[model samples]
Target: MASIFSRIVAGEIPSYKVAEDDRHYAFLDISPVAAGHTLVIPKREVDYIFDLSDEEYADLQLFAKKVAGAIKKAVPCKRVGVAVMGLEVPHAHIHLVPINREADMNFFGEHLSMQPEEMASMAASIAAAME
Candidate 1:
C-alpha cells in the first residue's frame, strides 16, 4: 500500500499544494502548528529521511529551501523554522513552519484548526510567492 503522502502525489488524495517540482512536493499540513505551516516531501517514498541517498537528500533540502523562502514571504513571521520529525507518517518529510518564537514550532502542542477557505487562500499565496 502507498503511504498517504504518495497518495497525495498521485492525486488520490486532496492537498493544499504550495509548490512542486519533478522530484518534490510541498503542501500545507492539515493539522498545522501555525498558519502557513507546510510539509515538504520527496515524490518517491522513503520510510526514513536518512535512508535517502546522498543526492536525494541534497535535492530535497534545496527544494525545501525554496519552499521556505516562499513561506516566509507569504506568512507573517520572523522566520520559517524547519523540522524533520519523520514518525507521524511512514514517508520521510520536512516541516516548514512560520514562527515568531521558538515555541511556535512545538509539534506536540495543539494544532490550529483552519477552515478550508483559509487553507486554500494560504496555499495560493505561498505558491504565488515562490521564486
Candidate 2:
C-alpha cells in the first residue's frame, strides 16, 4: 500500500499544495503547529530521510529552501523553522514551520485548527510567493 503522502502525490488524496517540482511536493499540514506549517516530501517514497541518496537529500533540501522562503514571505513570522520527525507517518518528510519563537515549532503541543477556507487562502498565498 502507498503511504498517505504518496497518495497525495498521486491525487488520490486532497492537499493544500503550495509548491511542486518534478521530484518534490510541498503542502500545508492539516494539523499544523502554526498557521503556515508546511510539509515537504519527495515524490518518491522513502521511509527515512537519511536513507535517501546524497543527491536526493541535497535536492530535497534545495527544494525545501525555496518553500521555506515562500512560507516566510507569505506568513507573518520572524523565521521559518525546519524539523524532521519521521515517526508520525512512514514517508520521510521535513516540516517548515513559521515561528516567531522557539516554542512555535513544538510538535507535541496542541495543533492549530484551521478552517478549509483559511487553509486554501494560506496555500494560495504561499504558492504565489514561490513565483
Candidate 3:
C-alpha cells in the first residue's frame, strides 16, 4: 500500500507544497505544532528512515537542511528543529518545525488550525526565501 506521503507526492491528495527536487518534497503540515511546520519526505516509499540506503539517507538529510534553511528565512523563529518520528506515517519523513522554544517542537501540544489560504501563503513565502 502506498503511504499517505506517497499519495501526496503522487497527486492522489493535495498538499501545501513548500519545495521539491527530483528526490524529495517539502510541504506544510495540515495539522501543525507551529505555523511553519513542514514535512520533508523522500519521493521513494521507504517504510523507515534508517532502512534507506546510505546515499538515500544522506540525500534526505541534505534535502531537509535546504527546507529548514528556507523555513528559517520565511518564518519567525529562533531556529528550525528537525525531528524524525516515523511511527505516525509509514513513509520515511523529517519534520522541520519552527521553534522559538523547545516546547514548540512538542508533538503533544495543541495544533494550530490554519486555513488553505494561510497555508498557501506560508508555502509561497518559504519557497520564495529558498530562491
Runs with alpha carbons beyond 4 Å of true place in candidate 2: none
lDDT, candidate 1, 60-110, per-residue tens: 999999999999999999999999996869999999999999999999899
Q: Which residue ranges in model 3 land beyond 4 Å of their true spot?
A: none
- Per-candidate TM equals 0.98, 0.99, 0.98
Error of 1 at 43 (Å): 0.3
Error of 2 at 70 (Å): 0.4
**Location of the lowest summed lDDT over 10 successive residues in candidate 1:** 83-92
Global lDDT of model 3: 0.94
What are the lDDT scores of the predictions, listed in order? 0.97, 0.97, 0.94
Structure candidate 1, residue pairs in collision: none
The Cα error of candidate 3 at residue 21, in Å, is 0.8
TM-score of 2: 0.99
**Could you tally the backbone clashes for each prediction?**
0, 0, 0
| lDDT head-to-head 1 vs 3, winner | 1
Report clash pairs, candidate 3: none
Error of model 2, residue 21, in angstroms: 0.4
Whole-model alpha-carbon lDDT for candidate 2? 0.97
Candidate 3 at residue 107, lDDT? 92
Of the pair 1 and 3, which is ahead by TM-score? 1
